[model samples]
Target: MKTSDTTDDLRQKLTHELARKRALLIDRHPNARNSLRIMLTALGVTDVHHAGRSVEVLRQVKAHHFDMILADYQLEDGRDSQQLLEELRQNHLVALSTVFIIITSERAYHNVVSIAELAPDDYLIKPFTADELHGRLIRALYKKHFFAQLYEQLDNGAFTEALSTCERLLGQESAFLFDALRLKGGILNALGRYAEATRVYQKVLEQRVVPWARMGLAMALRGQHQLAEAEDVGQSIVTEFPEFTAAYDFLAEVQQDLGKPVEAQEVLQRAAAISPNNSTRQRLVGDVAARNNDLATAEKAYGNVLRRRRGSSLKNLDDYSNLTRVMLDRGHAESARQVTDELRREWRGNRQGELAALIMDSLCAAKEGDAVKARHAVEKAILLHEALKAEGATTRVSQKMTVDLAQACLATGNEATAQEIVRQVAAENHEDRAMIAQVQRIYSKAGKAEKGQELLAQVGREIVELNNRGVLAARSGDLQGSVQLLVEAAERVPNLQFLVNATKAIFTLLELKGWDATLAKRGLRYLALAQTKDMRNPKVISARETYQRVARKYGVPIVPLGPSRSPESGPG
Candidate 1:
């Protein structure tokens, strides 16, 4: 019995030695071979298989799975070793963050460590001993465990909780300070606390300029309607970090908002060059090109976006809707219909899809001179609006839909209904200048140009009468009456130059009578609003100048203002 046991032990020892020799042959690196061999010898690890090449070895590693991966700093084709590890984790091709240790030479340290998120759990220097590698792996596991809660919160989109944890962690001044701050900024942005988010970003930047910090600041500025400032910041980021994609997005948005369509397209082109797979970027380029009347480029960009990817975040139905419109505009009705059919198949009766199809129906019917079909579609839209209204859905923006329906109604010779619809939209959105302009366009498009002009002229005359009343009231020293009339007139005829002038006059007279900081500030607010709508309108400029004078006279610091050109001469 003793002799038989001895024979079995000898056979096992031989098998183990052969396996070790095979493992050594598979590992090309001297350190990997030596360190792994040492571990195998210590553990007497049996059943080891040898891989013929790097691909084979990686496949075996994937199949067998290691508790920790000691990857070379420079992998096949100059790919970052850490990134390969992350790709494995991300794709579930490997277990999560399985103690990835980047094995690097001293010369490659900087190159290996330059990337974020893909930073290894540890770095195993050349000539590392088995003991050193093992120690680093254990340390990484402990550190990861310590922050597991934070990792989970961040990954699960519990940004508010994550931000709170980050704040607490920041008090400890941990090595993850910047990461915490960055995560906080992202959370604040997600929550729409753009101003606070911007402050946090700037705070980090003031310490040391970082690409993300700069990008975050630009985003905040964009949120605040400070597009010009955002554009400048975006340009600076691009100049410094030409490869950064987010900077290009910021630049495109700023330029678009500032009415520079061509510049927006240029930024989008640069972005596409960097990341062509992004359907959103391609669609944006196409939209901007379309806006600039560059049909050929627009068509190419849209076609690329539609053709390239099947299932992506960039494959929004809105993109297809917009593309279809462009196609129709380019006299490709059949092509537009093809896209519409594809969308119908994809969406499979979604409400938004139905709405888009209806809008397209209206457009097609209008083009084909089928006024009856157009009116039917418009009525369907109105019915949808009625349903939404019954539901008390506050989020429903029905004005645009109403305007569209009104236009269709007018086109079909339902003048009475069209007039009533326009009146309803005007009354509901009397405060919004952009909405008013859209209303005017809808009227003009439906062959009601004279009617639209008459409506605005009547509104203008009403505003003028109110302005005169306010002016007379102020001159007669009835300050309260003057303020009341002017405020009412301003509301009634917003963006009308003379009414704004009347409001300014009354506010200044009130301030002159007594110290009403609130009144003065209210006057400045009206003045600012007026300036934004038409900076070159005489009333806006005069009010702004008056506010500046009042601010100085009362020792109130003049608030920083926007462009306010002197208004052109108009009737007194």
Candidate 2:
């Protein structure tokens, strides 16, 4: 335990760790990347990569797992390092164990609090010495090592195991106690134990007023359906710490759920103004603004979204369609036509993209009062839609696009086709208030409001009856009958609620009557489908836990609830 001996041990550890690491240097200029590469090489990192653009950074991260990433704050694509980090973490493209350091020239970067849910491991100021960089890497690697097990459990979708790990870490007096507490609150919230999550956040708040802890508490309150209280807390965070943009998003969601669309639109617009480069937030603003009949705002927000994602890998047909739809709504037929032309150019030969373009072309022609052109476009779109549906490629099309197509159909005098399309989408998304509202708007626009109401009521009644029958069968001790009925309902509707219910019923039956491979496989499929709809839903989590318990009892391998990603091996 002598000072000299401890120093020697640390030196050996650092040398070994650096030698085994794969490092990435991201900067707009070649000289900056070369300088950083030299520094990394001097520190014993032999595996070094360089990326000069944000797109290249994303490509490299997706293609390989790097142990260390050093990115400049100002990227060549106008995106900051903070935004890149947020995108990586949000999409689960980066592992939690990677040591990310922001290399910045601005001293203000060090003083600013990160508004993202995930913060970089460290910030490396310009003109820093190799020794300083070495020290930062060692500290970040040590923290990653300390939380290795918990990170693994979380990445593997083992929330219960991660919670236990958090508890064990909290039992000791370590520098990471607060970090462990933060993870514990998130895990509890993910598991739908909102009351416990609230208490954990409260405990953290008692010690200090942390923005993240307050945000966590607000989320817990929302999970418990305390919308008013959640809104109040969210407002406080926005007012007191205006830099914390995440609060704006949370508050907007709460407002939307509380049936305050106008308030939600206002909140999202404020956030978009503050973080104009955030494509996701811009898209949200566009959606809400369109829903509130604010066409000018909708057009601007959607235009921003398309501009931001124009040449990026994240660009999609939805972005182009959204802007075109807004333009058409504003009676800018020529503008909408231009956007549709761009869509065709950008997504050439892609079936879904072609379909989207055709639909938009039809809408544009109708708006321009060209009945012949509109009819021709509608016929082509109808043919493509049928072809995709027959080939089972319809699932690749977004629900929003499908609704838009139906609206086009109504505009083109294809009432039966529009009605059929709306009916199918409504049944599949019976619980999605937003989609339902969109469908209602389409019908109302066509002056068929009464017909839309009748259709929705019929779909709602059918779903309720189907679910009630399954419940009745279970209550009567006919477990087999209950499973059959529920599975049938899931196959027919395949919404989140039905999928979760079916999976739960199948797992319950398996628990009572021993494992049936066929039944378990079906249950897993439904659970996966439900997760695709909403991975963080309490119902999905509960269903996953039930399946895990049953699978363990029967000695079956449990599949992960989240998407599979490359696992990171800790430092050697």
Candidate 3:
């Protein structure tokens, strides 16, 4: 086992270089951090930080630029390092230059989500020595450096430069040629150049079958609305690599789009079986399950969401709210009341939470045949709604909470309140034919279909007038006036197509006239409200793009429309 002096010298040099590398070690266990510290120290790494929680880890990454992040897959939080990486990437919190190497104890982690698809730098199993770990890190660093220009452009959201860089580097003989091609495919897909992306992915596939490349091909096809072909590709990927969670998720989305929600549910259920603890996955499972009228499955999925929320600060309150909603639907009054009680306890001082719990109580009371209590609950809810409005809560968010309030109002014989609530919903969603229909059905179920139609007509007329005036304002070179009129009109009826179009027109006017910071902000605010109504609305999507373009042109942060919520006004 004799080694040459030259080999020893090279090892010493590599070790010295690694010592200067800034590293961050993240694990929930103190012992794990200590162990990793020792291992990394052996590699001559002197600068390192340890974080036992994601919040702290994120704080670290956000505060300092780390060269390497060695994260344990299983963090104390409900999410793993993969989820952490996702948050970091999606929010642009970290540069792609930072090498992320995830460490997991179980091989099963590999089957849950595709590391290649998500593009984490590397994956390692437990019981690895410093040298093996170092070897992996070296390759990852090499890859990161080799694709520096592409990553630089990508991190800056410079798709054109990224594509050009990938193209230039792709035809040359390089160790990272396949990686370059993958990056090119990703850039093309991001730009919605689907046919070119398909060719790039196919080229990678011809070189060798890769999970990420196959998934990219499926995604490009889906982008082109080639649902059947995308499904085939997605199904094959999942069949061949059952661990590819993205494929399953994509396939399920395609199925839902194709009106095969039941199939989507099955696909997600399988993914859940493999990665049971992912809250987002569980939430999606609940949504599809509920959509398909599989209440039992839906309840179980939301219950899973609730359980996962217990220890995690990143709680989605909708899980508790939806749990109560469906429990009432299933005629489980006691269960619904208990869930509402838990929600109240969990969010004791929250105004919105208090209102939601009150709404749920009314539902439970009605289900339990307590008319007086239900009516009183509705009255209390009305007061809470007024109180929130007094505290500056926008009334334009026509979501499930408001729908539940309307439903509670009707259940409690508060017909006037019910009419006003449904009317507001109709006003906001004047252009959403489906939602308008749902609102009509809401009244029909309560024996007020004709009245509902009249209210919708009244509100629709008001929205149309406002929209028409706003269009005239924009056309007259009154960009600010147009923005004000359109945003106010949109807010009056949060999800109206007319108002959405008006916002888009205002955005265009602003674009032509150059950015007015306040007006552009207002435009985003209006689009965000519209998104809460129907994110898939074409008008909303177009306005969102326009808003981003203005934001980018103005050198401001492109405000992302807040989270897209589950439809609150959908047919029960």
Candidate 4:
């Protein structure tokens, strides 16, 4: 039969079915039943063009600004039921409130099982009764309304309020208890309330070992700097739910933070193997490989991203940046230049991207022996960073960038300017070990190894002296005096690893030897500061464990603070 004739007959059938079910029909197809047309004469819905194929009609209705959409999974264009549902979701034409129904034959059940991505609000198998459709539709719409407020708060990033709404719904209706638990856990995790989040996750684990709940709990533990515990939980999760991609992602992050780059790369590789279609996972694997200087692996990963290019958007500038750097390392300077040029053109207006592009440009110019152009680009890069700082951009153009500019200046024989820039940054960040290391490396590259070593030793001695005074004050039995001395010491050397580490040791000793509640808390504050200074340090790890043990010994219920803030943020 012709599509038009078939649609006409189906429209009549739908009219009879709606009357049989006592429900209204808002068909998007142009075909209308003579009986339905007469029936609509009494009702409303005068729009006709808004009413042909279900998928296109829904898209048109959205552009035309309709209140709701009633779409069947099957359409007249020989598209299967699942494709229609996927299209709606991908296009976001189906809002959280939008009601969708799948019209399928019994044979489509096997097809439905094969399709992992399509999800409809209601599914109607052929030979289903009209009463079943009405009952299902009413339930879906009512549930949508019930969760409307919760959805609204989440969309607006008011995660705490979303948790409150979930609590209210879960109390009044047992049916939504699991959903409430999930939402509450998610919000608590986002807010860095990991200890409380762990409790919520424990409740979820009681019912079932959900991968998401397991991953959430693991993340909370990781936030607490409890890497061993997080790794244990992640291992269990991946073993049981090997297909869960997020579990591997979290595992990779925790492993990388714990200084296990090879393990992290293996985890990411396993995840990519299981779900080979994920471009982001491919990119991450590439990054880990590139960091290890595994150019071959990095190239393969970048090739995957290039093959699936989403077209000239700044979709993943880091991947392109890393790719170019890898190419440069491999001595494929032309390929490196080509990638940088593409990114430069694509991200011309983005200040951060422009800076990155400028850095790459300077590097390229230096390689080509164009000292004049390299000097200009490096100067431009520094000015761009100054502009960003003035505009209060949250992104930091790290002190490393300053070091780079200095190196470029030095290379071009602008020794006075290079020396001045390096001196300014070194003086300003006198206590930052990583920045110190970077400065030393830059000077060494410029064949000034003795000067770099002298600078590093000078900074180290200043930090050691500050810490010694604080320790002497603490050892004098002046607990308050000790804390005051240490606090002042920390302020003076906030970014110094040795100074921060000493502060942490003092706090640990105080927690063990004294019984002051405020002092114990203060100890935690310092331990967090130490961890921030060197997150993966074995000494920081031991100090944190000692602090936690002391807190538990006193029954103080010390909440593990989430991801340590930068030491410069100070004491909070």
Q: TM-score: which candidate is best?
A: 2
- Write the residue-wise lDDT of candidate 3 on 473-517 in tens digits: 878978768767766766665555655665686678777888777
lDDT (CA) per prediction: 0.61, 0.85, 0.74, 0.61
Please, what are the lDDT tens digits per residue for candidate 4 over residues 1-572? 23244434644444343332322223334443233344333333343223345444555645653323444444453344454445444444444445556655688665554332334556666655545644555565555556678765544334545668878887773456765676677666655677988998898999897676787789779878899899989888878877666678788878877888789888988988875655667888886776655778888887677555435221555655657656765778788899889888776787777887887777677767788888888888768867886886613445555666676666666767777667656654675544565577667667888876776566557656866777787677665666577677655544544435455655566665765766566666666656544553435544554555566666776555433211111100
Which order, best to worst by lDDT? 2, 3, 1, 4
Question: Can you tell me which runs of candidate 4 are displaced by over 4 Å?
Answer: 1-140, 157-160, 306-316, 345-355, 368-373, 383-572
RMSD of each: 18.1, 3.6, 6.8, 13.5
Q: Write the per-residue lDDT of candidate 1 for residues 321-352, one digit (tens) a residue.
A: 66765676677777777886787777675655
Candidate 4 clash total? 4
**Candidate 3 regions off by >4 Å?**
1-22, 42-47, 53-65, 77-79, 87-93, 105-117, 148-165, 168-173, 393-398, 419-572
CA lDDT of 296 in candidate 1? Answer: 75
lDDT of candidate 3 at residue 267, scale 0 to 100: 100
Q: Residue 237's C-alpha lDDT in candidate 4?
A: 80
TM-score of 2: 0.94
Q: Model 2, 160: alpha-carbon shift in Å? A: 1.0
TM-scores for every predicted model = 0.48, 0.94, 0.77, 0.54
| Model 4 lDDT-worst window of ten | 563-572
